[model samples]
Target: MTRVRHWPTLAVLAVALALPHFTRGTQTEFAIEVMITGMFALSLNILIGRLGLISFGHGLFLGVGAYLAGFMLRHLSENLFLLLAAALIVGMLVSALVGAMVLRLGGVGFVMITIAFCQLFYVLVLSTQTWSGGINGIPSIPRPKLWRGTDLPAWLSLDSEFTFYYVALVGLVLLVYGLKRLDASPLGSVFSGIRQNAARMRALGYPVRRFQLIGFVMAGSLAAVAGALHASLFGLVDPSLLFWTTSGEVILMVILGGVGVLYGPLVGAALFLALFHYLGTLTDHWRLVLGIVFVVVVLYAPNGLVPLVTNALGRWRGAKPSARGAAVALPEDAT
Candidate 1:
């Protein structure tokens, strides 16, 4: 029975991880963004869903990570692993400092302060146009090597667009697995408790502020992972990376997919990217169409697509009862 309960989730993951090999063309870029966005949304979920904190400057970590990756590319080798590590370290250090200051605020005050801080950082980056390349963005970032030294057939190169798609997918799988395990742990329970009633938690002797700060730092670190991957994929870092619009977009993605569930972000990201890609290609007013879709989804499916689909599937599965009992009904009368 336990296995039955878990199989569907595992199966969904397997299919998602395998998606890159099955699609081609415009899907390459869209898919890559979805994967990266999935990570971003999941990281945000830890704070918003588990800790009940809203962040409006999450992109600051992402932008910092990306910028660090760009800077490292100049002096260091273009190894994906090294670049990701550097981004994470720098991101965590920056977020640690920023979280200390912002963690003192609550609710709307917290949100606004976060946004202001991110903008401040963004302006500072812009001021250093010589190093950050200003609005033009860093360019020509080398793609990650697939295997250390063995060369592959030209067609099977990881330097291609599809490679980023698969890398993002793999990263999502690992991130979700780790987060799910954490969600089921005792730490997760305490986090949820804090979210439900921070004052009570403090009275009960929990360090609410410290826990929240840790959550923020962890969320920032995970977001940096996504940003590092994005820099690698896009080969650039710019002021736009720290824009509030980017942070808003990630929040929307989380809400559209479902904030609390592990699979919700993946489903939301895929749908979000697909819509953005097709709708943008169809008309210049893509945001208008997207806004309408967002309204409809919020109104009709407030829990997001994952929960909605899971609920529907649960009903369908429940509606189909076993037929074995009916076939053996005669035995009941005999008894």
Candidate 2:
């Protein structure tokens, strides 16, 4: 029964794993973008869906990761593991510092403060041209290379798009799995409780602020991972990465997909990017078209595409349960 219930997830995984083989050129590049965007959406959902924190500046962490990775690749080694580890460490520290100041505020105050912080980071990056490369942005960032000193097979090179796709795919899988475990744990339950009723949870003796801060840090770290992946994939890091608009796009992905659903972000990212890619080819006013589509979706499916599809499928299956039951009963009678 458990396996049956997971067929959709398994199917999605199979499709994602096989996507590169079916795609070539721009399609493969787009797939990598989708995966990275999905990672960002998923991380943002931790705050939006799990903790009810509507941040308007989550891109700050994403930028932090991208910049950190870019700086390391330029000055240090292009080790994938080290880049991710550094990104995670720096993301956590930054999130902790910012969260300590902002988590105390809720509602609009929180949103404003988050946006302020993101803008501050953007300004700082622009001002520090010596390190950040200013308005033009850092470019030509290299991809990871395996066995730098040792003689290895040429096919094992991570610089190839094919190899990098799988690396990003695996990283995303591990991230999703980790997040699933976290979401199912007691800490996740506490986050839910805090989201629903912080005062009540506090009355019950839960340290609400601490838990929220921890969640903030965790989400930030994951966002950093996504950012690092994005930077490596694009070989560029720009101030725009930290802009509030980027954060807005991530929020849009979460809401468009379905808040609180584990795989919703992936769905949202795919759909959003597909629309952006296809529509941009047709018109310069793609945003206008996308906005209209978003409005329609919001009106028709407030809960999100994933939940709507799930509910429809449930109803369709449930509608014929009596016949299924009778069929099972007939086999038992024959036995």
Candidate 3:
């Protein structure tokens, strides 16, 4: 019965999954960016929303995954699966090591430290001009060959914008659903509890640090997936992946969507990217407009657009609209 009730949602997802194929050029590129950024936001949510950790160094995972993908494509196999696995493993290890150190800090200090770490990575990319091409960045990254170099179907060609869009859509859906399942599991309960009250959980004998580190690693792994896809989709990767603004964008995305809700970031990403795509066409000051919108969302709906809208709709639906004179009151004196 519950499954039956969810059919509408599933139908919506199906339509979204198919919608990108009909578009071409910039529209398709925008759709793919939305999907990939949505995944990145979700990965951030795992840390900020579920585990109560705000990592400003998340670009490390993203940049690393992209560079790793580029390196693998150049030197090793172009098999997408192999590249993704390698990227994820590297990302997890990077996060685990960083988490072990940063998890001990709290508040603004931690944020500063993470930001510093991200800057460190960015500088390294710039310094390795021979390997990473410095500011020029890697370009013309090849798309993965289908079926180990066999002839590809029209639908499976990464060279086709539509094919890549659908691939990213499917990947986002799968990852989002997987995150939802994880959120419902016992481990998720512990993570949530830790988010709400880390001290209380510590008092109750939970290994708080361990749980946090694991959550960090999970988030990093997912972010790496997004990063790898993004690199393949763009057919390029650059130091911009390690930029502080990149991390800031992901943070804004999670905040704009209600964090901890599996689908919220997806919605937020779509809206955000749509604005960047369309509004950027109108003026050179699109960043100003975006900044204003973000400020409004933060001030008025800190829990995010999805939660605010859903709560309003729920209230409206649950309320019984009173007809004229529907309510009567007796005087207290009469009682």
Q: Estimate each model's TM-score.
A: 0.88, 0.93, 0.91
lDDT of every predicted structure (CA atoms): 0.77, 0.84, 0.79
Q: Model 2, 197-313: lDDT tens per residue?
A: 777888999888899899899999989988998898888998899889999988888877887777888889998998899989999998898798789878987767777677677
> Candidate 3: lDDT of 327?
14
Candidate 3 residue lDDT tens string, 1-335: 99976786799888887787677787788878888888888898888777777778888889988888887877787777787789889888888888788777766777778898899989999999998989988888887654476677855557778777777877887887888798789999998788777878889999988898899899988888888888888888989889888898887777777766667777778887877778988988888988999899879876778777766655687954322111111111100
- What lDDT, from 0 to 1, does candidate 1 have? 0.77
For model 2, the local distance difference test gives 0.84
CA error at residue 218 for candidate 1, angstroms: 0.7
By TM-score, how accurate is candidate 1? Answer: 0.88
For every candidate structure, what is the RMSD over all alpha carbons to the true structure, in angstroms? 9.4, 8.4, 8.3
The residue-by-residue lDDT of candidate 1 on 1-335, one tens digit each, is 99987898789778866776888875677678778878888898887777887788999988888887777765575667777787778778888999999988887778899999989988888788888887787887766655445466533444776666767777887898889888799888888788777888889998888888888888999988888887877777767989888888888887778767676767777777777778888998988887988999889887777676766676687854222111111111100
Ranking by TM-score: 2, 3, 1
User: What's the candidate order when arranged by decreasing lDDT?
Assistant: 2, 3, 1
Give the Cα error of residue 326 in candidate 2, in Å.
30
Per-candidate clash tally: 0, 0, 0
